[model samples]
Target: MPMKVRGAPQAVVAILAFAGIVVALMQTMMIPLIPQLPRLLHATPSDATWAITATLLTGAVATPVVGRLGDMYGKRRMLLIGLALLVLGSFIGALSGTLAPMVVGRSLQGLAMGVIPLGISVMRDVLPADRLGSATALMSASLGVGGALGLPAAALVAERADWHLLFWTAAGFGVLAMALVLAVVPESQVRGGGRFDVVGAAGLSAGLSCLLLAVSKGVDWGGQVTAGLLGTSAILLGLWGWWELRTGEPLVDLRTSARRQVLLTNLASAVFGFGMFAMTMVLPQLLQLPRSTGYGLGTTMLGVGLTLAPSGLVMMAMSPVSARISRARGPKVTLMAGALVVAAGYGLGVLMMSALWQLVFVSSVIGAGIGLAYGAMPALIMSAVPIGETAAANSLNTLMRAIGTSISSAVAGVILANLTNAAGLPTLDGFRLVMAIGGGASLVAIAIAAFLPAHRVPAGTLPGREPSARRAVRISARPRPAERAGLPGEDE
Candidate 1:
């Protein structure tokens, strides 16, 4: 009789994808709690806002460092460490009744964001070449999936249960993800054996912290403080670049990253991130805006969640389709196509701002485009970089996306803040302006993607299908660098 069970590759991919979704859920779960934070923590609004800032700051710092560590030691090992941080942070967030502990807890949660890239790297090392495209795409889409689905659900829980329950819930899921990783996910033996680059890591962290703090918090801190932070970031980043070029065991391989494909992909990733977030920030406000405003839909948070939830599903659903496009056309083409779709979606959003259905249409269309772009990104990065540096490259890409989102928040917030109506509320014109910007950003990303080199399918192979021969070369049903290739194990 034929075997009754799923393939080992299938199990590993499923478990890791679930882990990605859970970790992503941690990010959006806190959104509904933001408004109530000042009252809940008995602090000023500015102090309470630190909960969000702390996570953003820590995430930007941790993504690259953790990626390098994952490459040097073990991808699976670093992923576990990331999950542990999530569990610990979730519990801390649950127990905290004040701003300080809350900030600390949230920072740890930010640190856990590294797991997404690590998970993607592990997919490359462990999965058969054929499974690589689709699995990584799904894992990447989980970031959006978790965020979209998390909002309304998180809002409901915060509205009814004690808000602490949200963190408790996240902690529970983190524990489940940990257990799944131990049981199903194999440790990759593909270690980039080298000493950790302390100087590069510190320089990058300081530079990112300075820049993101200035971008994210500039509105509150005023122009001079923002200028000072920006100046400091510039100096630190320049020094960091010099040190990286000199370091024997650099934390990030600037030379490899400078290659045309990797460089352009990262640039486009940032723009795409900015475009995605512009929709995320504006749509909710449009939904919640008071009915007295001529354009407001006047919906509840739950309505917002329901409207956005379908986009997450659409993103998940589009993964295989995106993969097919990448296989048939090159991922560069896939990326450009995705960016164009996003541009089209946002352009439609600018005109169709009237009803719930129109917003749903807009979100779903944008989500589909984002899924395509994100799914193609790993393919572009992994194809360009060596097997050993997969984690680092992917992590760096993720960092770019995060930076893009931060910038989007700053820029979008500025637009909405300044373009207010007579009553001082953001007018329909303000949102349409944001939507126009989002479309323009997506179009810009498409232009960037146009610069990417074309991909040619080797002769005698079918388009849109992973080579069947490659699919058959299974690697010992374990997640290690191939013994056939004389690769060293993680313990080495």
Candidate 2:
């Protein structure tokens, strides 16, 4: 029999949300070390960048694979394994003085990126019906919070202490998160029991590695190398799609993904992801550029991070608001509202970059949009897919967003590199151009969101919600007065 573990719903939600934030925090924790990596590790500037590139590549490959494993084996088991990897990676990083070990450690850290999606999936299986929406909203927005908060925290650590302390602190946090999961979060009884698709897994990994590596390194690698990698990626991905369709149990269910609601949401996610990265990439550089540049703010790294930190808080604060909107108007409308706001934020950013306060205001507006949009995506996806497929579906959606960010990074890099001033710094015009493109990307997402179903059962109501609640009623042999009055039933 599947083990059905139970616990206090609120504690479970908090533990999972904390785990999600910790995992997301790993993504940007190393940014402050990038310039110093060459001198510290005795490597060329290009080679030192692998420390960041390794994480991005590994994260792209691991997210979907781990999600499938969680669905087949157990989500809590997979989540624990991810946290264990995070701890091990941090320990390795803490000891590393060379680029090689640092890259290896960062790769392992990336593998744990699956934890956020798995945490959201667990909420669906465990939380009470009414608690599920807000819980998942908070979980989804945790990524933005971790990333925004990590910048200042990491900058402070890099400035004051031995850089290795960053890894040690990360290790300590991972250990704490793991212990909380073991103590509080329950193993989900739901499972998509099937033979592991080894061939599908390998095909997808190889394809994504080639695709993402090409996109990420294209600006640095020049045209022929980028073209060759793109060709290889396209061929491998095409074959993988063919293989998945023929397999008994595929790694990703392409047919389910092709559904109008799911298809549009994923499409919007990619564009929204593209829109999201523009601010993260643009704001810090603009804030830290030399004061000699006509528009540069000349702030220190710590100041840049602090200035942007409120955006993360704004995201967190918007989570419940997103849930409430999803509950009232449907996730489709919530998503549209979010994309529209993000577009407006970028439009404002283009006109407001002369002052730090303007940048903060723009970042916070963009953050709120991202929070609403991110909170709505899982709801749209879960509502359209089978209950057992939750983790895998959410993971794929996460992967799509990662792909969008990778593309955004490449596009922004090319623009900045080519649009430099006499001092070799990015010109104000280049920053404005990137902001315009970001707004355009959000506009595209809004257009896609418009095509989604006008109303699917209210967002965040899982496919299994009513059935599971009814089962709870039967097992308890006493329905709550709210259940007896059919409030949960009204969601359907």
Candidate 3:
């Protein structure tokens, strides 16, 4: 059972969500600085990218590791550690005038990426069942919310002030959020106490690092290096999977992850992540390209940021709507509906991009779909897994989404690079192709979601209650029959 907390539930949700937004803001804070990093940090363009790549690689590795650690230790405790890393990273970044230290600070910021999934897990372990749906929905939406809002905020800062001030602002927000978490958020009493899986952690890290590095940098690194990295990743991951099955206490329990609902939800998450990121990649470039190109909107970075900001607000606004849909028809239906909406959004982008308003409309539709899909994902995962494995399970799902986005970034880069015009800039056709591909990927997610087992209300629950609502209550209540015999050594 979830531990009852003395603090108001609303305060807990707000603090955790704020922490999520701050970390997400850090991810995008450097976006406006990307083009300037070469000059500012005294590095070549190629070398400067490591500052961004460092964060991506570390975040991919950290989500699962810190999630497992959060489960073994306390989620709130681990969350504080993540926030501290963010603050420390921001401070270092503020002080750095060189590429090496900047990359180090960015890597530390990436380590805090586990905060979102950890926050969802914390909510699962403390909030009242009545509040879980909308609360988790909002928490999941925070990733998009922060990214959307961060771009405009970062853009304005980058345009008007010394870039160092951006990091200072991030540090200030981190400190405030950290203090609020300490004051308002309650530590989950639930614990999966066991010795840390050192070898498992190392193997998983090596595998993910290899895979993400190859995918993200393959365009710059050439075919041979990319192929070599990919092959190594495959071998490392294969061995890691084998070890996980045989080990007494694994970092991720393959058996639980293999459950039909968990399996399908993860597959859908990857496809959805890929589809969602394709929009981000295509939109800004289209917006910022010169209007002489006929297809370009001829806008500044700040304009691009302002245009996309509404989509973020729409995503947050859709949380309650997503929760209601999940409660009415089950998360399965919500996921399918969300995927279809995303596909429609991309379809609109491909068909109508001559005006800024059209792009905003396209993005807002996609963002709404993302909010719904993201919100439903945790409900699907948490419903399937044991309470003890909430953090690890959610972390794994988060990792899958990251992998999807990385793959999307690589594929979109290839498309945009190869299909350029006379000026060596990506043409309108390439942009449309990318949007069409995003639509196709969303369609694929719909197919995968179709395979998820229908949500079933627990036996002995009141029949009068909505099945999804009853299911949420059961998820927060005592273990169901399926979860009673969960992974070996799980606490009851």
TM-score of every model? 0.92, 0.94, 0.94
* Shift in Å, residue 304, candidate 3: 0.5
lDDT value for model 1: 0.84
Candidate 2 whole-model C-alpha lDDT, 0 to 1 = 0.86
In model 2, residue pairs whose N, Cα or C atoms come closer than 3 Å (at least 3 residues apart or on different chains), thus clashing, are none
Q: Weakest 10 consecutive residues, lDDT, candidate 1?
A: 483-492
- What 10-residue stretch in candidate 2 is worst by lDDT? 470-479
Q: How badly does each model clash, as a count of residue pairs?
A: 0, 0, 0
- Model 1: CA > 4 A from native: 1-7, 457-492
* Candidate 3 Cα outliers beyond 4 Å, as residue runs: 456-492
Model 2 over residues 1-492: C-alpha lDDT tens digits? 112446678789889989999998898899888889998878999888898999899988999999988888888999999999999999999999999999999999999999999999888777776777788889999999899988999999998999999999999999999999999888887777777789999999999999998998887788999999999999999999999888878899887777777788999999999988999889999999988887899998899889999999999999998889888888888899989999999999999999989999999999999999998998888877666677999999999999999999999988998899988989999999999999999999999988887664444464324434412111211122233232221232
Candidate 1 lDDT over residue span 121-240, tens digit each: 888766766667888889888888888988889989988899999999999999999998998787777777778999999999999999999998899999999999999999999999
lDDT of 3 by residue, 235-262 (tens): 9999999998887678888888887778
Model 2 regions more than 4 Å off: 1-6, 456-492
